[model samples]
Target: MGISTDSTPRYTYQLPVAAAPSEPPSAAEGAAASLQDALLVGNLLWFVRLRWVAISALTAFGAAGLLVRGAFPPLGLRPPTGWPFLIAALLLLANFGYLGHARWIVRNPQHRGAAWNLWVQIVADLLALTVVVYFLGSLETAAPFMYLAHVVLACIFFPRWQSFVVVVVASGLYAACVIVERLEIVHTPGIYLDPLLRQAMTGHSAFPWVTASSALGIFFVVWFLASHLSSLVRQQERELADANVRLTIAQRDKTRHMLRTTHELKAPFAAIAANAQLLLRGNCGVLPGEAAEVVRRIAARCRRLAIEIQEMLQLANLQSADEQPKPLRLDLAEMVHWAIARVGAAAQARRVTVDADLAPAHVVAVEDHIKMLLTNIIANAVAYSYEGGTVRVRCHVAASDGPVITIEDEGIGIPADKLPRIFDEYYRTEEAVRHNKDSTGLGLAIVRHVAASLEIRVQVESAPNCGTRFTLRFPRAG
Candidate 1:
């Protein structure tokens, strides 16, 4: 509901920068502005419609009163039919004019002038209601309560101070009407009747003073409560917006720091792996058996470390990218086959069996991210499974839930307590660390991040020594 200012710069550079030109809004910015304007116009139109309803009801009530007076002369209670008709006609004319103005503002939102428009409408409504109350016996009848309705409306659409101003002005006008009627300055009929209940009573009495005082007291109390509640809600909304802005800033800073550190580490590890591989292959010279075996182990570990650094860099880039990858139509079955092929070597090394039940289904997603997500899940399953255990992968469309991809493995399953933190970066369970010492613990984290970017839902079910199942549900593309 609130708009944030983009005064904070996104990035800084050492190089000299050129002055940027003032340009038109981007598509996203324009769409957001258009949506805001549309909402404002809708609110204004709704207020205008409510006024039309109020005016119609007033006209109908006036006509009914005139009919009752004509039919029963013995009642002897004179109603102000002529003045009600005149007031209703004037109100209808003003409402029709304001409706036209509201439509014009909707068409020309740049010139809407909301504050002035609201003030004019509210003041006019208060005046019209005061006239109606006067005609309907003022403080004697329940028509004075109508001012409270206007007070509530003002509280909803106006600022707290402005609504209070409305309460003050309305109370003053109604109090003046009561005073004049009590003093015979205007000969309006009162609500009381004679002993026979057939004649109206003339009053210069204490009842009007008491009624006016009570009405004013009620008005102030209603205004105070409504204004205080509105202020609290606005304050909460502003606080939430500020918190979100701070979180976004902190995330961007963390991503930048990780990207720089990982880039520096990757190069040295790559050189170390290359030199160790040369020595192990006898490219430099033939060495003792023990020396060659040590070099072989060093080369293998370095290569694995390099791969882990590369994955970390990929994750950092995914987090920092401002624009998301656009989704494209792709075959789910083909993507699953690609992922199986990716983990074929790992599965073979573990002596694990791979099974797939794929149905021909198409979805919309970034092809590379989806393929990488599948590869990570399947590779993790292969890495964790026992020798000769089964790794099952399935893909198909559900009757009510769109397309789903599931990978299940009879692996050393995660502990119940560690399930919640499994997807956190560098979070490996104790059992997992014992089974595979070289595990970087970044596979599930990568899987989670990629799935989120592609709008896929991932659900996990596992028990210790009972195997684990990971299910991914994809939304249908129109």
Candidate 2:
């Protein structure tokens, strides 16, 4: 997901540049690490896909040269179809290997570092391209320009020093090929007619020297410009990430302050309810009929407010820092049963029957949060159900062994338009409010927080006056 660009802070003075990605604060190192890993994997995949284009270009070049071989001598050209086809075949096999290696890195990240994977790819690709450059004539054709692809990519994905290394290696390989060819140590049938204007150009002793020198200069110049631009981009990305972290910290601190304030408010609300109860019970003095009715309403509202406040505090605790419960492997079916038990009273009061279909499904998550998450959803299922309705609770693992739990209810279903806001704290649809007067509207919000914390996905399906189904897909336990 994209963070809001507006969050980037404006500065009046220029900031000093860092040689590397600045370290994110200690609290968010994991985020930075994850981002880098993803970038590596993504770049690896991109390079593999792009290689197919290179292979096709080679194939087409070979086919075209072969088809028009008759016209080559007239145009002072002597291209070889066999070499291009051979290079294309080599690239085709290597591409398959690259694809397999990328998948292995994704599945078994600990086996190899991402940087090592990228470096291997860069070296292999440069070697292959070096061969292509030699065959096509580093000074004879535009083939040397292909090295810029690696230079630009290296700049984008690597630090300044690492990018410099790639530039040096590429330039060196091209120079080596050119020097050996000129020295007649390795013979190459460069694409030129020795009989035509080509011999005049080739006879110049300083021509290859100047061409090689100019190409190397351009390579270094490109590395400098590309790396500078890439560094600026990296700087912006780090700043954006830091800004997001700060925003998150500010939000958590705000939740903590709200948690503290709610704690203080709870007592006053309780006292009000207690005094109202005393009046209703005639503990102080007998009250007139109208006053008694008024007291009853006040007491009822206070009780309802107290429940809302309690759920609010629960949510605040879940969102606050330093309060997440430790994760342990637990059975999804067992948690579902425990949740059913927790909501038994409400289900019984509403005459709602719960049907459970348990399967062997397990996940690693905090026990209390799991219970709280399940209990809240189950309670809502019961509360919203019509009298004598049935709520189905199912737990099972998917074919991939990722656990799934579903809670479906035969209730006054959520309106399609209002379903989006159902998880918003304190948000309730008019239909929901009319159906369940005492609904606190925080149950789903709490469930959402727990699901997010556990890395579970919650998908809802509903229709007005029909029924609603919530599907919770849990990440496979490690």
Candidate 3:
């Protein structure tokens, strides 16, 4: 006979009786590619956001001061008596406004539209800044210094082709300004070059060509230095990134090796202990009193050591496993049946009965990982159970949630204070320690790791002297 219900459940169990529904690549390259892309994108975003703010602010301040000065008085030449300075002022203001918007967007990257707008505004501002510099100073005058800002901006914000383009455009604009000023179309500063001895005695003039030539030369030098520096920085970033990846991999491998070694050592010990128990039980032949007692103690200690090794191995396995998961369709009903079948015999000895109500549903998960995860939870339910206790495993499926598997046991329940620490390695409740001293205190810890790897949300509910319940919910696949 099985537990009767209005609806037929997937799995049901009775003492010596059952009704059941049962069942049961490139990874490395993809992981590396994903890691590389994440780092590259992250770095690009940082540089763009930081440098854009700095350049835009300085450009706005300088343009505003120029506008204010030109509006008031003049230096030897007449004020730009037309739309030139006015247009420059407006462009500078717009650039400054957009820079402020960009800063806000940078801070809140979750707003995709704002971030996009910021990028567009930065590009427009760069263009506007280039034009303003041309009007303020031509190659023979202040144009050279203007290009210096563009060169620096290019080196920081834009990379190869774009940086080159900005420099060339600034230089070309400066040259054009020089020609117009010299023709008397625009008010251009005059140059008075001094001899080497004369220049040593007096400071350089405020002339166009002389100053433009010097400023333009400085622009080139700074541009070269910035380019060289950026290259070095990029190289160092890449090296550090590579080293970090190597270190992670080395750490994972080391953990895996240790776990595997622990498992290897544990297997032989388990076999020895099993044989010793059989001999002591007289499964082969009757043993003397002293020999039987000694065998029992040896077997018991071996069992304890085996559990410790198993726990260690589990930790090692989880630490070294792939970060990226391999997902596949999983049948919740079948997994419940399979898990019960695996741990059925162990529970029977303690007279613990399993009552599972799993529904027919599919979720995505790694097959072996899911099984190992369930085994730890179900086995624990059975192990902690008292004689003639019941372990109920229920699965619920909803339109929103694909499947929720809950394992609840009516046994020596955990205390409220100790529930939080139950998942920690080497931790056991006072009740558990008193009831069973052989526990290695790693079952729930392993369960936690497996749940995390599969992206499944797991939680527990317990009341002292009542029972414990562990629930695992799996997200639905699209």
Candidate 4:
């Protein structure tokens, strides 16, 4: 039996910052730990009463104790007059003591202790079995019970390989005991009961036949029980795994529903924002200076509101993507240039110096999805950056991966607490929401969803006042 010596280990989990990685324990280990704890709690009362060793130990000793007391001189029915029932009683008492020690070992689970206590119990059991076999005068009378206990111990405390080895050792002990008894090597008293061979049968020896039948029965019964227990454990493990899968599906469905609602709301608001911008640009004819400026501010706020709504919808769509990615070979360098060019006007308006370094390669990804991922990241960098600051967009080949893209901006960066959850839907940092009051906080969440579907990794590094860098690493084409 390999023992568990570590009380705890680090667990990994996925974080929300785009493709940030966090370590948490796998589902299987957690399920096993929960099952073990539940079983312990369910049997708490019984464990406390019997001191936590197997119930068989107590029952076996109790039965033998009753038999020993009943076969006393006062009963006046003892056929084996010279048999040492007292010795059998003493062996039963010793078993009780060993069980107490086993319980102690169970209660105190030492992560780095020797197996000294376990070895001691094994030796004590062996010695006790020897005494019983000698006192009973024959293997047919005493050795079967000892063999049964050995089998039980092996199943409870040992691995399959070790358990089988112990079973072989137990069978050998039985053979040795039987041989010694048959040869009359021991001179203790023996008990002989009548054998019902036929209708006219008289008293006949049945010890050999009975012992052989009992051993055969024990082998089959233990094997069946072990097989049944193993099946139960496997069935429960599968059920737990299925439940976790269902939970993930439900979470996605809820996120999708929210996104659809946001999209429905944004469609009308986008038209309203556009018309307002048109009027402010003199489409409705010229007006006084002060009135024109008021119209301009209203148009700007409406545009900001539209952007926030669009971001919310983006968050919902990112998490709700259920279909397989429609892959096609396309020039990724051109796509990057296209995205940067789309956002170029806005960056130039803010006096933000935008730079790009692109690599020539074909990438297989959905065109619209990649566009959204790139646009949001670049826009966020430009929006946060000060006038005349730099926003760098780089695309290159990674040594260990496929295409690697990074967008970095010189701007007031994210705080430590807010950085970890930057990709969560509707999650906005104080600084981000302050920069644009109507920020929808869905940009990074959409980025995560797209990367997850493509089996890509996204990472972010940022510190307050030190600017932020976002990295996207795509898997190579097959």
Candidate 5:
């Protein structure tokens, strides 16, 4: 080997080039793609089943036509020979095989190449229809129009180019059949060809050719338009899917940023509030009334800022997919009492009285989330209520509906126009802002998000100055 290397270099063989790796789909992208594939597969399976049913029905009808031909001669239907019936039975068997194939594809996780299966079905259908049309007097009767069904199915289930391929193959097969018949290359027995219609449009010399050309033209035009429209619809769907993905990513990023910023802000406000509290308590030194009052106000403002930051954080978490709620069995009445207690100080401050009608109702929900939901709605009611107004909290199980918790307030009610926007984050009705200048506008947004996450239905009824009622319908948990 050393001696050979000294004299000449050995040739090295190059390996075949490998394909580049494709990017893996994200969870959301994968889910969306799976949904689209499922829809396509479902449509194809439905069409296949429908075709089987149609074939069975047509076979029965054909058999009946043959049996009753002499009995009812005035029906004007010519009795077909046994050959067509035999062909139909074979087609039915083929269709049964296809149905089995389709079922396997649907049930098997490893079978992802469904498009190929669909193409096979389309081609098989086209060939079968061509044979039937030939047996039914090719071009003389309306049997040739049966090709339109294949075209329509291809347009719906296959890609544009695939559909075009179908149109071409179908048109070619039909034209070839007509030409062969006209040339007397193959004679189909017991089949009627209408001579008048064939010779009506063209002279005898080119009548069949002209008729075949016109039929081909119609097939091409119909398929072209149908395929074009289908392509447009598919393109729009892809564009919409991409838009949704982008929107989801953008929203997730926004929520993450908001969560981080709020967390950062909370720490500083908490420290400031603690220091202000210490100063207000005269821990440093004795202070004048004015300075003490100012310090107290600073402490209160810091506390309010802290609460607002907390609300923003909660809302961000609720909007995020990362935060899964921990659901547990909870008594509705106890949660309602806890919510009323949490807002007791606020209610007392506003001079609002809370009335409750308790009922024993069990539901599966995240305790903190439910508590937060109840607190926000009840606090909102208390905030909007006038001095000495009544806030009613009711927990009951309706006969038709499951368990219900309603918070009704005799405070300043929301206007009908603003009801739709009340749950929007950072959105405050003008009345709400006037009622509580310190409102963060995230309360009802949190309520809605939590309710939706817990699968609880919330309904709001309100009229300006009359009252606002918030109804939460909880699905009973076993």
Candidate 6:
């Protein structure tokens, strides 16, 4: 419904800058403009149908003229039945042609043709309206008001100058129609459709000129108001869009700043944990029992915090990193075994049995990403499982399913309602937190991020007491 009449809007798109905030380009603007083109197409269809209605009305008026011609005297008014029918028939043919052109334009994807077709429709309608004006008595009837519809439509669909061009064209055409008839340049039986109205204006030599001037002024006033409002609306839209883009850029910059700050704290935390360990291990002089116990607790908390910090940094790095530059082929069986080994200590600590059903399958991906992805899943399975529970890992290539990996565990399972948030960074369900208080909650977030980077699909299934299953499906290689 909104239209721009001032400067053409410019659209551009660019990736977010790393060091400073900047406006991203309007990357998908063609898609945006297509909506307007689509709207224009719909409006054109509506107007084409409107013409059909006009044709019907004209035909009905002509029929009424014929019916009236026989019963009424020529004293008061006389309407020419044949001329009205001729105009309607001509309009019917033009409407059909316009409709066929519109259909042809829509069948093609390029919208440039649709715009030109609108130009033709508007101009052709104007020319037809001019004829209607002459027949209905240009200065005598209300036919000139019909020109305002096209004038308003032009302002909506085109820029200011083009709309003014339409206004000028309308004014000139109406003036010409009135003068020609008044001067008897093209003689007809009556100067007006209503004979009595023609008689009333016959003596007034300046009536046609005065009427034409008033109508021309009306067209200019309408264009000024419509085009001005349209320009204002479009400018506001652009300003709002730019403001939104700036807000998004500012938010992204804030996250990058926080993650960079977190990354910087990693070494200090590591050193603190190392020193605490040293104190507990008697690398320094032996501490008192109470001091030793406090140091032991301090070391554990530092190590866990260090792990959380590392995972947060990794998530940030993964988000900013480009796709693996030089991926290589690797055996899933070997990688799965390695990932199991990575989590073997945790499984042992929790008294959880880890089983692997590894089949020979080859996949191409960044070795480290897939390795970490699998390790995280296996580690999670072991972490959530009850003592003496079993965790199974499966890796195989199915004929239709391509390469697949599934890690299933008999753990304190996620609730159905909370399953969707399991991959959110630092997100853990109440049950997950209760079962394993040490979780960083970034394990599956990392897994899902890596899978997405590799274009792999992930599916999760779980029940409250029945544990959870994580399935990783690699897209079939072409």
> Using Cα atoms with residue i matched to residue i, what is each candidate's TM-score against the true structure?
0.70, 0.69, 0.57, 0.52, 0.83, 0.60
- Each model's lDDT comes to 0.75, 0.82, 0.65, 0.62, 0.77, 0.77
Worst 10 residues of 3 by lDDT: 15-24
Error of 6 at 470 (Å): 3.3
Question: What is the Cα-based lDDT of residue 357 in candidate 6?
Answer: 91
Worst 10 residues of 1 by lDDT: 10-19
RMSD of each: 11.2, 10.3, 11.8, 17.0, 17.8, 11.8
**Tens digit of lDDT per residue, candidate 5, span 1-478?**
0011133222221112222211123656986878777877787678777877767766776787687767434543456667556767776787677778767877884667567767877788788777777776675567788888888778888789889889999998898888776666876642433444344533366666776788888888889888889999999988988877787788788888999999889878889999998897789998799999998889889978888999998888777777466789999899989989999998898788999999998888878888899999999988888888889999999888889998888767777667777887889988888888888889988887787677777788776677778888878786
Alpha-carbon deviation at 271 in model 4, angstroms = 3.6
- What is the number of residue pairs that collide in model 4? 7
Of candidate 4, the 10-residue stretch with the lowest lDDT total is 194-203
Please give, for residues 1-478, the per-residue lDDT of candidate 4 as tens digits.
Answer: 1112245221222343343221122443465555554443333323234332433453454455466756543533224332234444554565466556546545653421213333344445555555556554434344466556556554544445555655566556665665665565875443333222221221236655466557746754774476456556656766886666566556666766777777787777777778777777788887679987887787777777777777666655555534535778766778888888888998998898888988876678878778888898898888887678888888888778888888888777777767767877778888887775555677777777777767777777776556678888777866
Candidate 1, residues 91-161: lDDT per residue as tens digits?
A: 78877877788778777877755556667777888888877777666765778888898788778666699
Clashing pairs in 6: 12-25, 12-26, 13-25, 14-25
Model 3: which residue pairs collide? 137-143, 139-174, 140-208, 140-209
lDDT of 3 by residue, 360-431 (tens): 878787676677788888988888878888899998887676688989887776666666677777888888
Q: Model 2, 310-356: lDDT tens per residue?
A: 88888887876664667899998988988899889889998889999
User: Of the pair 2 and 4, which is ahead by lDDT?
Assistant: 2
TM-score-superior candidate, 1 or 2: 1
Worst 10 residues of 6 by lDDT: 12-21
Return the top candidate by TM-score: 5
TM-score rank order: 5, 1, 2, 6, 3, 4
Most accurate candidate by lDDT: 2
